[model samples]
Target: MKDDDKAVYLGTDCGATTSKVGAVWGDGTVVSTKLLQRVTRSQDGPAAVVASWVDAASDFLSQHDLTWDQVHGAGLAIPGPYQRYGVLDKSPNLPDTFTGFDVHNAYAGALADRAGRPIPLVVGNDGNLGGVGEAQHVRGRGHGTVLLLAPGSGLGCAFVDERGLPLDGDTLAGMEGGHVPIPLHLLGAKPYPCGCGRTWGCVEVYTTLSGLPYLLEERLEKYPDHELAKSGKPMKERAFALRTLAQNGDPLALEIFDFQAKALGIHVAVMAMAVDPRYVVIGGGLMDPEATSDAFRERYLGVVRDTALPLLWPAQRTTLTIVPASLGDLSQSIGAALVALYRSRS
Candidate 1:
């Protein structure tokens, strides 16, 4: 390959509370990576968040002693409900300022100003990008669809076909599986309001970190003697503490984990029935084996399999496998880089 053909690509993953910036060669070797917290805050406003992304990307290039001329293109992944052209329609986890923001143009313009020339940039849904990363991770495992499920501050879902490409079409809409409704009868407790401002329950309300408190509240009266009920810590802290207890074999904590796993399984089963993905790759803070416990991860997977298998059509039961994400938190950024490389090559 010529020097020009050895171009590097930039990728940015802007999540609700944090963002990641990195550069990678066309062959997928990571050049540099940085994890930034509070880089994009709805409260800080959309423009500020976009500026933060550009600053982070610039820093990544500088740290590596690289220049825009060496970068063939850039790709960004953001929390969505966005247009194919990169206009964010609305993001449930993001602030109202992002409702109609021209995210693609803003990032491209800012980076171009830094580069002193326009750079090709592409943007897509974060979860969809994650699917691309996970698909790449499991490329040789088999030839079938892969479902990427990210359960963190919120829940996200994406699909990748057998070719390891995101299954996006003309519209950037249907993949918002997080907002899929949860039948009232399936929800044992009062429906918790979603970040999207829906009063009725959605899969997100029971699967994300934000939903833990509501789940705990329902079980509080039942597990009055449990440590979670006696604690006065903040909801986030309490959620972690509960996970710790679950890891140590506490009955109440185990019950909570079981409930969450089952709820997640229902959503996964629905997706599997609809898409019939060969692998379901689970990612994000809530499901990380390192963040929680290996036992927790195992138990969660066991429950998911137990809940989903019987519900699956008899022949399809043996076709789907639920596993932890191979890329862990790096999925989105790597996927973004892959997108950039794909675009540049095309």
Candidate 2:
């Protein structure tokens, strides 16, 4: 493992349905043009899923004429919380088999076995990794604390502290901000069930990709003759298209996003009041240029700012910068890789 030898490490972002394998330099340069992807096969069980990802990563490296031993370090970004580095604590989104599945040493040992030697490969929750990746990305480095709001399948909130490390440590290990409670009235939302089994008040219930479906049902009840209800489209599909429809001036879509953005903005305010991070990074499919139109992005962000600004302290209200996430979908993957590299050096 020469720091100057230009070794390529691997980073894997494991999602519920798929896993992406990427090649990266220790300096954080992604070597693979297209990320190598594979179905997660979570239904096969945790052990099988873990081994498959490792094998897939191994093969991805081989395509670059590299092997595990030639790698500097590797990192895995898992979707759920865990402790002792790799053991899974809970996984509501994954199959029931994943609960309490101890990954403590088996995962690291398996990597060592594959490389035929001890190399630095680590695993961490995806939320924490997203903050880490942005902290190390060229555009985001040296920016002091970063508060990241990731609003995709679920709402993910993470922090990279002023020290250029994830905010997680022993006392706050496995912290997940998505489940933090927010006022439901922010969206005129009722106590809808969250994926975490909470009946109400979770920030995720109103501000994520999954949350839209619930919002749709509630919103449509009042507008029974609304175009969305009459279209006969699947709830999920309709919810996903909310941004597009809003951009095209669909009144119902605009109203729903207005509520969603306002709720999300309030969530951000509450978190910012606690962390006081210098940068607030908002990202995910809802606002990605590739996923939604700029018209929609502007409207959503404007609503967020309007809803949040007055809630902040006067000083932070002026100094805090809110910007879109720079790394987009690649944040967690690259962050995991950075985690490996940073931990190895530390």
Q: Which residue pairs overlap in candidate 2's backbone?
A: none
Q: Compose the digit string of candidate 1's lDDT tens values, residues 185-209.
A: 6647567788887887888888777
Please give, for residues 245-302, the per-residue lDDT of candidate 2 as tens digits: 7778888888888888898889888998788878878877675677778788888889
- Alpha-carbon lDDT, every model: 0.79, 0.76
Model 1's TM-score against the true structure: 0.90
Q: Candidates' TM-scores?
A: 0.90, 0.89
**All candidates: CA RMSD in angstroms?**
2.6, 2.5
Highest lDDT: which candidate?
A: 1
